[model samples]
Target: LLELRILLHGPAGSGKSSFINSVDTLVDAVSHDSFTTEYKTNKIQKGEPGTFYPFVFTDIMGLEKDTNKGVGVEDIKLAMKGNIKDGYKFKPASTISKDDHSYNNNPTLNDKVHVLVCVVPANTIHLLSNETVTKMRDVRLAARDMGIPQLAILTKIDEACPEVKRDLRNVYKSKSLKKKEFSVSLGIPLNCMFPVKNYHSEITTDDNIDTLILSALRQMTDFGEDFVNNLYRPTSSLQTGI
Candidate 1:
């Protein structure tokens, strides 16, 4: 099985569930409400032989401020256990001290996160509050600390104006400049960001959303390649035979 532990984190109502649902229709069962995914996994099997085995996707509750003090954080830690079996063991998100709490769970400096997908609302490109910016920055820092490859998904693009879309692209290009500035002020390296428009469409034609989603998946595949290259060198002991 080509197992991957992909994390989807962002503020409430950022379309995290929607993005996961777009990847596979089966995920729709667990996608709902503002914080519907307390903790769940959706599996997609590639029907073709010689192709990668089923890909399991774990969806956790949205990480809010003070999530570590709540039950939701423990749920995320529990989910990490499954990833450990897949060769990626994350430090339990629950064990981190309250004072040292971070948005992204960093079990160790050498932690290998296959991919970190940060969701942002496309309609509100520059509508982030001070607290939101801080949280976003911390996520970026945590990804950097774990040496994980990362990408940003700008959701709800259909609801955004052209001007907002342009601004969103610029912010993405600048690593959400305001957040990047804060990271720099705090001495954190910014992770690379990519802007993807993930939306649900009524039409099922060739020009429909499936194409866009497939493109996004391809981008993720490329990012995964780079992450594996960085965290596990070809000559390293961790290298797999597959």
Candidate 2:
């Protein structure tokens, strides 16, 4: 049995790493001034020992304003197809080639991304560079062509909306978010986007935060399972004769 692989890609400081830490306590050390320069896969441990959730998450270097300053679009495309291996350092100059030691000669279904999740900071969504948005769209197109399920997590909702900052429950009712505008800007459907504030300075978890994170996670697993199941589904129709 293979765990479903969910790939998270977004611009630097979008809270991709923080989101992972919030969900599974897998710390990747998020920094606004720096970018994650490696490809890493994270797993959620269950209550029991030597056991984990059925799904895993893979995070790549954050997308940047320039292709040469951050993760290459080609590299993200390669990752979607499972061409890149874990612990591989990202090189903004160029994508990994088949000749590279980190390249996977043959990636199985498990190695391929079952779900493609785009993590974007709610506060900085409007400030995203045109080049970065284009790169994101390019990666999204690749994932779509591969028939991978996709979703977008809008992180740092509290910072984006004052109402939500006061009360987490008002997240949906807050008018300041302008979900439609962001949906159009990011190229992700309004329904596919989920907004949540990642745990930052909190010494412990909060029920409200956990609720939002778990909701998104549930959808991730659901979409991932559907994608994997559909792969084995028969393309031809079955006929029954009386």
The candidate that wins on TM-score is 2
In model 1, pairs of residues that clash are none
- Residue 62 miss distance in model 2 (angstroms): 0.3
TM-score of each: 0.61, 0.92
The Cα error of candidate 1 at residue 183, in Å, is: 13
Residue lDDT tens for model 2, 1-242: 38999999999889888888788642323333136789989887777768888889898899999758889999998899889999999999988988999999898777889999999998889899999999999988888888898999999999998889989999999887888998998788998899988887777667888888988998899999888777766762321110
lDDT of 1 by residue, 1-242 (tens): 25655667666677777777667542222333345435454455455544533344555556454534222433334333232222222232453333432333433322224666777775664565555556666766666656666677666654664543454344333433344543343333344343445544532323334555666566666776676565567777766633
Q: At residue 113, what lDDT does model 2 achieve?
A: 92
lDDT for predicted candidate 1 compared with the true structure: 0.51
Off by over 4 Å in 2: 26-34, 236-242
